[model samples]
Target: ELSMSGGALRTFSRCVTCLARIGSDLVFQAYPDKLELHTLNSSRSAFASVSLTRDFFDHFHLPADAYADAAPSSTPLQCSVLLKSVLAVLRTPTSAIDRLNASLPNPQASKLEFVIHCVSGRKKTHRISCSAESDVQTLALDRNGFPSRLAIRPRDLTRLLSNFQSSLQELTVIATEPAARLPGVDDGTGGKAVELLSYIDPTKDDYDSRLHTQLWIDPAEEFLEYEHAGDPVDVTFGVKELKGIFNIL
Candidate 1:
């Protein structure tokens, strides 16, 4: 309480309504000796997907919006519209990929593009994060909250999306290997100017932290060549499992 520690260790939780949307209750807590996160969920299981993601951004305060609405027994932050997009971008990944290892000229960045019909079955939401590129790239987030497995790998994307119209979808990421603080290691941004986004914590701030990695993609021209050059045999987007991941948060 503010009166208990002179505001040094004050915490509280409550339920709230936003934009006419009746949301679940929220939780809040603060401690002087350490940083604490407050999360409020109607059900204990409701927050499983958001817990790790909240901590990921809290370290950087990317949205830094009110952590949550006051919930009767939940921890919640009233996040900004921009911050709300964070969760949709962090969900499970599906690889609709059909090909990889094609050749093309190397530019300042790499590009990847694909599309899922999301047809004939259960529609699920997907969240994604990708590398920055010469042109800003965008990952898709399903409007609904439910997420299916990421169906495409950066490589298979070439084959899977090959059937779709070229103008329908695309992704580009700058493959910059930034400069390393160490004597001979590269930083991985490829010596390009890095944008100063405060929400993105640098490697030095938390040395042991694992950074978000982007998929390596080649130019669009090479993949596009498959379009006009062949039959619809190269691309295949199907119900398949993608390996090499721990778990989707």
Candidate 2:
């Protein structure tokens, strides 16, 4: 069982909406110390997870022997439900919701129950059908393994992305060091920059008339933190996923 205060309920709603935009199903993994929500895109290329500590909830409860004598590799209680179903229960604005109570009840339960207490002295309950899942699908990634890192405000990045056409599907980001290209020719103003370019396969039949766009950004001005310690590199990914994630932020 889990209960969230008004503030936490707001955050939880946003998290659910964000996850819904990323994937079709939401996975719940309950542990003694925290609750985790995870989702993977249909193509299995994009995966996202959010962890909420016990303290984040107004009330959190689990059986004392939930993990008793369990091996280190033992899996936690896991289940999945359609993202849209969860969204239906959370469609009410946070301002109208005073508190949220959720419960799995037991391992055999086929539905997850959510009770929402409204600020206007009303109560609503929703039962979302769920299915037991054998395990959670997650990607193991080491952040430090990447030589380049940039931290920018979500709004800042969103503003930059706005320069592209709405129909554009993919984007390529190129990171470069101006000084590396020409050692002696490097001007005092030489610094790191990134080029955001709209991408479309040239092999496509209509490529000849497709619009091509490029925008250059200086990290020093746009990013709160920027570090790069290797050769220039470029990565291309779908823009729709990025826009969806940022929208929730």
Best by lDDT: 2
Local distance difference test scores for all models: 0.24, 0.82
Candidate 1's TM-score: 0.18
User: What's the CA error at residue 28 for candidate 1, in Å?
Assistant: 16
Q: Residue pairs in steric clash, candidate 2?
A: none
Q: How many backbone clashes does candidate 1 have?
A: 49
Clashes of each: 49, 0
Q: For every model shown, what is its TM-score relative to the native structure?
A: 0.18, 0.83
Model 1 lDDT per residue over 121-162, tens place: 433433222232201011123535422112234455545334
What is the per-residue lDDT of model 2 for residues 1-249, given as tens digits with 9 covering 90 to 100?
999967888889889888887788899888888898998788876677899998999999976655666742345666789899999999888899888899987856799999999999899999988954523444456788987888999999989998999999999998876445565565443554678999999899999899899888778889998777778889888888887777895
